[model samples]
Target: MLFGAIQALQIITFEPLLLQCNLWLLAGIALFYLLESGERTNALRRILRVGVVGWMFGLVLAAVQILPTLELIPRAVRGAGFDFDTISSWSMHPIDLVNVVVPHLFGDPYTLDRADYWGESFHRGREGYLVSFFLGAVALLLSILSFLSPRRNLQRTLLGLTLLSLFMAAGEFNPFYRGLSEHVPGISLGRYPSKYFLAGALALAVMVSLGLEVLLIHEARGSRARRGVLAVAFSGLICAALGLGMHAYFQSRPHNLEAWIESMADPKRAAAKNFPVVASQLNQSLRASGIFLGLSSFLVLVSRFWEHPRMSPVLLVSVLAGELIPANLRVVPLMSDRDVEFVPEVITYLTRRGPNEIYRIVQLDSPLQTFSGIWAPNRSWAWRIHFTRMSGQPMYGIMSGLQYAVFYSVDNLNTRDSDELYGRAFRLQGADGLNFLGRLNSRVLLTTSEIPYPGVRVMAVLPTNTDRKLKVYWLEQMSPRAYFVSGVESVHSHKEALERLSQPDFPADRMVILENSGVDTKPGDEGAGNARVLSYQDRRVLCEVDAQKPGYLVLLDSFYPGWQAYVDGKEAQILRANYAFRAVEVPAGKHRVEFSYRPLFFYAGLALSCMGLLFGIVSIFWSGGPNGFKAVLIYLKSRHKKLKAKNGLLA
Candidate 1:
């Protein structure tokens, strides 16, 4: 139930929070359950059964999404694992614990100019760690109180989970995370260890609830109330001291805010213009911290001096609301009308070009980077900008409903051949590079700068809502989506094929490489057969070919598993040609060739899902009545008797 609730809430954004929370909950439950079970084997078995059922329920519920993901994940870059250095980039620091208790200690990093300036210098653009895990001082105090509750085992288990999450969140700052990533199977899938903070937050929430219940007990006498007051007072004093110390440290720094602002007036130093704004926000945070501490102290005094039970709960609730509501408001600001204003002209223009036209558009400048200002920022201002710029480019193509040559996603399956093609088109200069783009069926090129390619004609100069200009060029000789080649060349390796492709006069349209050494074909047979594309679709292609003799028909499509080819209604072997495309041999005379994508794993998963659904329905019907248990026993006994009779007959 907890996992389901978390998953449903997290559907708004697919982050690792739910996964972290689920891991913590399951581990804590299993550990506590095991310890409590002791020598009782039946108890242990019941716990294991319940756990298994819950896990299987989760799996079955998510099978539709999981099945397709399993098929595609192995083909992605994340399948191998991320580099340690990259994964550690978002790690938390030991000092960042202050922020967990005191939230917005430096200021809101998601805003345009609110981040800790000094922290960014040493933390590689990260303003501060633990900013995302802030639960306020009130929650912190409650969590501490949970330790003294009667439910010792549950509290201890939660505390252990909290510590484990904190250690993992520290990433490279601690050794445990590194060791776990190396030894564990799915642990390496997480790029940001700080995401584990969600588990810590979940544990703390439970602890806070337990603690609050203890405090709210009406029967609590004078001493118990006094102790609670003392705890709150101590927490407030500590927070006050921390805030004052932080302010002193910032004041002692040699960098002068006035001078920094003056320096940014120079056009060359415009990048530092936001520094002053950040400094002001930091000062504001300092003031806010002092106010929070003062309020906490006042609440502690009220709880101690006053005896009314109703008043204590009311004051505590008011104080918590006062602290959290502003924080929430600051983090999530109202959206402006301009936020939704995108480049409609570009979308309209692309839509006007018939959707069935099987050609791709290549954007010279990554749209994500170019349109970073439009996307929501992250916890760290610098990282927010970087992430938005890197990931936003694909949105342009998606919004316009236009096929783009370059795409990026969590599961990016960029093969070596595809990478080479992309690099040659973008990095290489002159007509050779432009010709490669044409061969890749990129009919349109969108760039922020001019290119001196003769084959491309300037179509339009479109203006974006952000006041940026985009130059659109149309390639005169874009290749077909599915083409054929009559001649075949035997290449020993990808390197050899690449070398052959680099030649000035290499006939990309006429000749293609056959990787298998067994398939002997002469490179000189360039015009042995003729081929034309008859129909083209997203997953299926049809072509008509006339071969003078035995020749190969090559299609300019990435050769991946599950793609099958047929020639004249007979199944044919699909070879990986030109290092990354598909090819098939055809007999003499006219013949129809077809290519279709049909993954067997997907079908198998669908069948299994159907079976599971049927079984669930039958179980529900069979277990509906009050005598369901007796019915089940009888059914099992009958099955056992039938099996015994069958065995006896066989004997």
Candidate 2:
């Protein structure tokens, strides 16, 4: 809003340079503070200093978000065999959300939706709207009462502080979007790391501090206001004491702590994978509660400084809400996943496949409607039956030459017995569904999985002779199976699909057996003990004499227990690479690649950058921040009035 309002204002005046409005704002705010606080400081210099400091702070957060430290990632593991940085660019939506709400709440929550909302009256998904409304109205009402009260002395100061305390505590408004005139100066010190909604709470905190500071100054300046100051201060103390007591009784962070118990109690599966349904519901509740924590804690600190009798009663409410953002949000990210596990793959496959093969798929799914529906006509195929939702004809309305692949099912493939959710992606076309022709060229046919057709024909399924050969992608392309461009050099011990490479002729290149070949066991524990033996079995490499290609090749002397092979850079499936040792038919040219596992630094960097942002946010509201905001304000106000008056006559 600050930006938008300024832009609108500038349009009337027709400013010279458009984007550099921050300079203008700096000048304006400095002047406003000067006028409001009464000339007690240097206008220009102080204005520039505060502006630079605040902007620099924001810049630092931006840099950290873009930096490479994986601070953004919630979890990092060594040797996990997964990389997040195979692609460029860190996802910013999650980090941005926390950037707005964290400092106030002191915790970050998880959300899959990518958005950065900054508004005084904004709510994502849902908000305790009624709760927020009541708090805000009461706060505004208290502030009005104080503002209307006469007497700028210590007595008035106490009332003023009470009002400010109420404003900060009530928090249904987002203050970060405002200009320098919105809230206290250092209130948003570390604001960038938090979500925007917390800005409302932060703004209110500034008011609390300002009111208290004014009261302190008023009492200090001669007069018999000292006892009144102590009374107000003492009253604030009581409020603080009561507030803490209430917090202890009412504030309990939303936690999935029970997840641990449930996982252990479920004797059926591992906690790493299978989870009880209760954990999911708990996660949602935690997300909702987390939003409140940010608002509550902020209220607590502000109350300690500004305890007006009226404000004291409300302190309990604000403290509780502030605590909500931190408590409930801390666990939110644990559960948010914006992209479904299967969507990215569907997009990739649609982007890569060819026309004819897709046509064949259409024939297989909706045999009656396919132009060449001779093959797989009955639609009684296992894959089709499990995948398609409809029973008959309408599935082929648009799949004449282009196959309308309805479902991409994993359940139909290897885990048919497991009853997983994947079998529904691609199946036979149903009677009710209208098929839309996908825009894909014939090149996609080259990237088929176990079905391998069009340009990719499966030679034979030799499950006995293990040999998995293929380049490994740094980031696993989440899909039902591996996709290769017809250079069929994959032999997974786990998959029973016929192997057929671009070059069907087996390369007679020799393969080498590399293994640590060791056994770990205690003395005399060789029986059924923790000791195991590794008996070397004969392992060999055969190829169509790729003495023509440039890679190491030698027949393996023996297969050690944990031996595996890769034709190029890709790592083979466990025990599967235990044998793609059959052959490698590379284009007769020099190729460079390695088999060691590498980490995904790109994603890691994104994670770290976000984490830094998180830290920056928490640091902003460290309570009793760097002082002298009044000085900065005094300077700006003087300059602003003079500049406006001088320019006002001409306008």
Candidate 3:
């Protein structure tokens, strides 16, 4: 995309604004080829041979990568470490099972929004389908142009370069370059430039075929002049290959990798905490300039020894092998699935809390970099792939509205002793502010305790005990002006905060906040005949409900061993693992939203999507055969054979 964008700008543009955002980088590069012609030379065969030699070098790199991959190396680059833990992927299958009977599940997003969770994914599928079709068509055309173009003027050379750029671009941007992300926008970058490495393969193929043809036409004869450039390129390629190899090896090493992996084995561990630090260490070595510099330096050193053909090819091939190896294993270990001591209480709170309810996710930055490695790993010293694992990089987190709107670093988890962290800062202004308020999920109360700002008054303790470890606190303060603004952002009024957390139904006998705790099995049921008091975990709770359950109790991974859940009074099912939260199956009715981390079912949905995708791709492409165009003929032939088999069976 970068190359394409660059090329597009070079061409005519009535307005410069297009260059900033709407520019097509790849298209410009394609046009660059159309305008240039090959230089005529009698040593065509010799030129072809050189190109072929370069390609063979690429093959050697591929070999290096393939050997390890075939051996099942855990850190094998290309297709390794693909994660899709986002909201869109998990809610699919569970929604589908419910929708199967509902029948009103399929529709456009606007219409389907009311259907349920499953409806949204398929509805969104329409947009994704369109995007994928567009992307596939573009990839196909680029591939064809490179494949069919003659090797003269080294048209293949330019084609190879463009292809490399596009591939590298894809590798950098796409989540899983070959599989899932191919359908998305330009891929993000990583530890290794995948697209560029893959392009090297195509370049090798081109160079080899052209070189062999040239050798057939003319015997090998050449004066070794610019062996320097060749040497430098070869060296860089070699370093890249070796660097990635070492990285993968160290990252997957038994001692280093196992320690992190073991950490995650505990259900109490947060997947974010157990990230591999060794991977980061190696990433620093694989820095972009490292390869380029190493290669260049080596070439300069070996420039004097390049006269012999045998020596030259061997040296060049060694470099090529190095480059190819790293190129092929382009997977970057930006994050790993490791375990950390997960805050159990936090997870419980999130699960128990209703949907869209807000809560502060605090990280204390004073003693150390809290949540630093987990949220983002330090890959700064590494090569600048467009997308890298930088420390504290803003993440896309989903828990409650707090995860959505703003992330707090100086919020409700700390204490300022007796000196007043807020009072000292605001004393210069000479006036105390009104007490700030945050409506959970709606307007968040921006308290001095929560944000460490100027105006606040001491209130009391929450969860009512020091032993519980809840970050809740009590405070009173004022700030009509400060409330108007908090930091660079504005703050809503007290009334607004209450309104945010309150239901739109206005006056209620009592505010019925429907939490998607997934604890209650009977969704959409009422609060009719239920026990008034119950006890669990040394706490007394009251349950009141009607005959019709009218809410979503999605107990995502809220499973704790031996834990039993009841709605109103009836016991619910504990269908999955002990620690994992389960979403309670709601009965039929107009309901509220509550959910938990019942993920095993989500994985089942992903499996189904994968199967569907595989089927679709295979069915569409199988008929395209060796000739590449006779899809219809192949289809007819297969159909005929199937029909014959059916007839024989009947007989």
Predicted model with the maximum TM-score: 1
Best by lDDT: 1
Q: What stretches of model 3 exceed 4 Å from their correct place?
A: 1-25, 32-310, 313-405, 408-435, 441-651
Expressed as tens digits, the lDDT of each residue in 277-307 for candidate 3 is: 3234324334432453355345434544556
**Model 3: how far is 112 from its true place, Å?**
48
TM-score of every model versus the real structure: 0.80, 0.26, 0.29
| Model 2: residues with Cα > 4 Å off, grouped in runs | 1-32, 36-41, 53-64, 67-141, 149-197, 208-586, 589-592, 595-651
Per-candidate local distance difference test: 0.64, 0.29, 0.31
TM-score of 2: 0.26
* Candidates arranged by lDDT, highest first: 1, 3, 2
lDDT of 1 by residue, 426-518 (tens): 665778777777766778887666877688888777654233456778888766665556677788887787666655576776777788648
lDDT of 2 at 275: 33
